[model samples]
Target: MSDESSNEAPRTVRLDRELVRALAHPMRNRILGLLRVYGPQTATTLAGRLGVNTGATSYHLRQLAEAGLVIEDDSRGNARDRWWKAAHQGTEFDKAELLDQEPELALGFLHGVGQSYAENIFSFIDAVQTMPADWRDASVLSDYFFHLRADQLDAMMQEVLAVLEKYKTADLTAPLPEGAEQVTVQLQAFPRETR
Candidate 1:
């Protein structure tokens, strides 16, 4: 879902070559995502959650920070135990332009993003059995197929994002109700060439 407040549009940074290169690494992308979703965290804590060593996590965090995707959250920790947080609420990029300009880097970045999406889906599946009844009932993992022109597909996705923005607005305007939990809402819409 979107991350901005109801009063303001989401802050999205366009991907430049430097940022693309920084995020091409799967671990760096994961590190940035974790900081975004869960708030500021120390490298040690992130490493523990990511099943990696602190040194590696720290290195990735530094790379992300260098690209301005993340920043040290000095408010949260001491010098020795620095914390990191996402610099922007979201990111946007022209996929075609990137592909034409920096083919390898663009592909590597997209691959990491796709891998992350798959991991999120799989993690949810693995946890569904043990989730609370209410959450189980609320979750959805479904897809639809439709014949549409490229323009129509783009419009459909925009509408979907608008709805998600409504929910994100609600989140910022009020405190979440009891029992409310952070949920991952993923949207993937693409043409199927083979099928």
Candidate 2:
């Protein structure tokens, strides 16, 4: 099986109306996460890992392919069995566009993403206790209250993205530099409500 990230196409898709609808389900997001991180997998394998039956995994895989989020990896499985992988390294979209264009759909997508993110955060917390002290000390779960104008926040976000983009060309799964570890920086910024 080809599990190398370098071989896959670099794709970043902006979700449209249909794609957003296709991605609205929790199970689909979970499955996508597996494929995105683990590379090609069969329905039977995914079923075992996710604790779902093969039929359900297969069905959701078909739906995700319809939305162009994943694709069949014929090289990884025989005719009797099939394998799937994410078509893109990751997805990108404008949250503001979703809010302005389709509020209802935006709510559903945002809720789903929020749920997935919470699950991941908790999982990281669960594993932190077993990690080396150096890593644990470096990792932080923090929240900051900012009283900034919208433009200021946008500028701050752009600077953060610029820093992240410096490492975009490196293959994350490969051996890192002398002092580098894969770090996931999840950013969420929202304005506070008026009293």
Candidate 3:
């Protein structure tokens, strides 16, 4: 998630060992993602949405805040119902660097991220049958295998990301037009060892 092309540059945070360690927890990752996707929300609200207890949600939120992944949004909510939001719209890091520096931390963080992506894909699959004709027709769950050098793959990924960024919905907080829906697009590129 990033900023609108017309708006100010997107806020991005670079991941370090400490930050990655903080985000390695599945719950904390989910909390940060919820705040980013849906905007600021109280622990109670997040708990209800995530089906977690308020206490647990609050604890995770506090951890994320301490790690600088999220921040208290003083503009909304009162003392009793404090609101929290994602500090950055997106994150940037070198996976190889992190893996080399802290294998366990990197693996844990990547596992959590991969699990989230799988969950989203499964959710869509579960609802696809009941989805409207228009949406169902528009949905995609396909992958292509490409044989390319590392540099070629990297260049292709950059091009793909640039295209996605161009078409990304500008304001998450803004009301969507009729028939519009929030869509999730996931991209994964890695060299698989041949059997």
Predictions: Cα RMSD each: 3.9, 4.0, 3.3
Question: Which has the better TM-score: candidate 1, or candidate 2?
Answer: 1
Tens digits of per-residue lDDT for model 2, 1-195: 344656766656788777778888888878887887667899999999889999999999999998889999978788788989888777777878878888888788889889988987998899999989998999989999988999999999999899988867444434667876767778888898979
Full-model lDDT, candidate 3: 0.89
Q: What is the C-alpha RMSD, rounded to one decimal, of candidate 2?
A: 4.0
| Residue-by-residue lDDT tens digits, candidate 3, 33-107 | 888789999999999988989999999999998998898888988768899988887888899999999999999
Instruction: Judging by TM-score against the true structure, name the best candidate.
Output: 3
lDDT of each residue in 1-195, candidate 1, tens digit only: 444545433467899877999999999989888877777889999999999999999899888888888888768887679988888767889999999999999999999999999999999999999999999999999999999999999999999999988777333223557887888899889989865
Clashing pairs in 3: none
Off by over 4 Å in 3: 1-10
Error (Å) of candidate 2 at residue 95 is 2.1
Q: Candidates' lDDT values, in order? A: 0.86, 0.83, 0.89
Question: Would you list the rank order by TM-score, best first?
Answer: 3, 1, 2
